[model samples]
Target chain A: MPLRWPRRLGLVGLALPWLLPYAWMVSTSFKTLPELVAAPSAPLPSGLNLDAYAAVFEAMPVGAYLLNTTLMALAIGLLQLALALPAGYALSKLSFRGRGLAFGLVVATLLIPAQVRFVPVFTLLAEVRLTNTMTALVLPFAVSALGTFLIRQALLSVPPQLIEAARLDGAGELTIIYRLLPPLLRPSLVAAFLFSFVYHWNDYFWPLVMTTDDSVRTLPLGVALLREQGTGVRWHIVMAGNVLLSLPALLLFALTQRQLIHAAAGKAAGR
Target chain B: MKLLSPRRPTDPYLLLLPTLLILGCFFFYPLLAAGKLSLYSWDLLTPPRFVGLDNYRALWSEGLLLHSLELTLVFSLGVVTASTILGLALALLLNRPGRLAAFARASIFSAYIVSWVSVALLWLWILDADGGALNAALQRLGLPGWRWLSDPRLALPSLAAVTVWKLAGYAMILYLAGLQDVPAHLLEAAALDGAGRWQRFRHVTWPLLRPTTAFVTSTGAIASFQVFDVVRVMTQGGPMDHTNVLVYAIYEQIFLNLRVGRASALVVVFFLVLLGLTLWQLRLWLRREGAEGQSPPA
Candidate 1:
């Protein structure tokens, strides 16, 4: 219960192991090739360098890829929000037939990995003449089972009294969901948005399956391409690429970390 | 707060429209189409020919799938163990008292933000045969450079190791969230009663962390099953296909072999296996729920 250093030293010592790999990673990212090869337990770079970073953007369509990734992530996040928020509100609050089954179906779909569905999805896209397009990458993920579930949980926390009062006041279902739900569910929505965006930005499987060229590649897929390029593994560029790859989500995590943790913890408590 | 209307009878359905529409077009349709394509041999260019269960029979008999399934199990088990142990350790560590603990949490989760492809790249460099960081370090230390990726025996384990390295932090973050809700006074009380650290942790802390452990472990296991990027980028399921898993096998089936029907069968089987595992987890959850609900006064 004390705030003194020794009282807290054990706790801080616990974090030391976690800090090691990242320190290595960040240290390596900053270190020169000579330094990296010189010692395994090399110290942090004497100073930061931008050469590897510059090469990362130069070697491939890093700029376009980043732009594509952001836009696709944003598009997917917004679309999921648009689709999931309402459907989740409806499923949570509405008295409707087949509601249980609909909810069950969504839960069931959570078990179907995108990899399992990739082949057929690819074929269907080919049939629709949509292969190798950014749309192919983003469209399938626009409505997420995870988002729907999270939003429903958020909506369930809204009082029935609120809905009942709204209905009694001649408010329509759509209006109640848009107005009543958003105000109450803002935190959940924000959490979902950040989660979805970061997740999509980091997703590799679907984009890998759907797109072939660098022109439409997402960041994760782009990073994969660097490996497949057969230029041999370039450590510095790869480190730069990883830093670039992780920066956005890393930044987002840093920014909204408190809220994200709250949401995750709340959900863990079965909220 | 404004209360919007359900005055329109179709509003609810409209609200569900985008979700259902996207699910149907993107998800459900492809799943159904996957089933349909599995029954018929058609590789995009060919006219569809009905070959019901022929593709399924082939993959089942070939041992390609059985091998992949085995590898997937091994890979999942390895990653699950490594991730959980390291993650739990990290979680416990960061849950301690100190200023750097906050920074430690951030740094650990920073690993999660790295794309799998990049993580694979990072490890690939680490395991490179010639002048690789790890190999170079070992040689410098007068030790043998372990041929991690190239050795068939090491391939799956190496993949698992890389995956664990990538995900341990994320799992730690989840467990950290769980740790935060431990009702700290319990630990304080336990300490006052002559309880040593490990005793308190084992009897009180670990028990409370069950839900979080269950969440992290199950999610980690399931996610590991989809370990295609690492396999693809790092080894491409090579070393004589020693590292191949179900996802990459399915990938090879459809893209490389151009066998749509067979690939679809793999899809069905893969989904069923995952579904079975998930159902098992759900059953355990329900039993836990039932037990909790029926428990005597605390």
Candidate 2:
């Protein structure tokens, strides 16, 4: 009820505290070790000194890893959407049997930490000789339990009169899904797509455990490897690589967080 | 009419196809094989030997697994409780009208996109104990500087703090959604009834927030139990394995120690713990819904 400049100023003041670490991360990444560990308060690096990034590249193929992650995340997101959309339409719109059991099973799989089967997956991959392949990175994740459920829930809410009219016009299941359902479900689809994109992009455990070779490393693992040799780790190098690993996802999320969060609320409440 | 039904006839099988096939290949088959493998002792480099529960017996007698289980619980409980409560508070505060609400929300969220690896890498420096940002700030404020990640006594809490920082933003979004759905009229009525802010929150707001609470809490618990990245990057189950959690131990068992059988047992036990908790939640939730349906919305 008053001009509470103190509270307003305090909130802004507090904001800087949280952001200081990120500022440090960005600033230190550009600084030399001497500058980073300086005795007194250090000024932010003024220009491009990519020594940390160069160290990251020399220790491992950080570029190839970024490429691998980009390809893997994009592939998994695209392929999962392609399959999940049609199948979700069928699940939510079509009168199919055993749907409960199927939904239950899909939901159950979400609970199972994919880590629980690490040894078995590793052994199976080894047996199939798919180890160290990007296929190994992308295939298992191409089937997303959450995406199917999300799209299915979205489609379930689309008015059935429209579906009936389309079918009355003799539009096949594929057309109904690809044309009618997806358009109405665009909000939900975008939500699911962003979730899937970020999920796979940030996925570290499977990629770490699965791919031993630098040739197939994703961005997360690439940054992890950048942090250290056996003796000492350079924090600046690791932070630079962290920024690289995260920037794309961060950009996408910043652009779509409102839409994504709104859709999530819509879908969750719709259920 | 048919579409309104949660299940469709053939769609269930089709809905299940991807999850089934993938889980079969990646999860179920491996799990069952790991079960079978657990019964036998194998180095994995050579032909497997059929030891038939010798590994289990040895594990029971050794009680090394009991140690890992304790660590796992500590890791999960500490991280889950801190993150969920604090994250929820941040969400509620930022959910109100403010100039910085949008800015704070986005900043917290930016942390989410960064991988756990990145989060750990960043905090490792921030918590570097000597000249890192954390210590620098503490010392400048004339506070005693503590080694955040390296000190064995404080390492686990240090790990928990970093994780909470990383995840609080995501939880904030979940709660922000929940807060928006709360009917403003109900809060106004409470205010008219002489309810203080805390009382209004406790009575009018908190109960309405249950569904969001359920979703966030369940997801948080599941994620925390399966936590590997933070531990791997920050501690590596280290300062001499003082921080060895279940999944990390499972990693060490299979990869480092080459004990596939023991690792499988750890995983199997963990699955039971997670699945058991989830089923318990579902049953309780259903019962709560059923009981509440008999009452008026007010």
Error of 2 at B209 (Å): 2.1
> What is the C-alpha DockQ of each candidate?
0.43, 0.49
Q: Which stretches of candidate 1 lie over 4 Å from their true place?
A: A1-49, A164-172, B1-8, B181-193, B289-298
lDDT by residue (B1-298, candidate 1, tens digit) is 2233344667667777778777777677778888888898977788889987899888878888789889998899889989999989888766765556777777666667656766776677667777466776687789988889999988888889888887897788778877876888999999999899999999998998887777777777788877888888888889999988988988888889888888888888888788777776666556556633211000
The native-contact fractions of the candidates, in order shown, are: 0.50, 0.53
Query: lDDT for each of the candidates?
Result: 0.76, 0.74
Tens-digit per-residue lDDT, A41-73, candidate 1: 454677887666777777888889989898989
- Worst lDDT run of 10 residues, candidate 1 chain B, spans B289-298
- Cα lDDT of model 2 by residue, A13-54, tens digit: 545645776777888778776766564235477567898778
- Model 2 residue B160 CA deviation in Å: 0.8
Report the lDDT of model 1 for residue A53.
76
lDDT of 1: 0.76
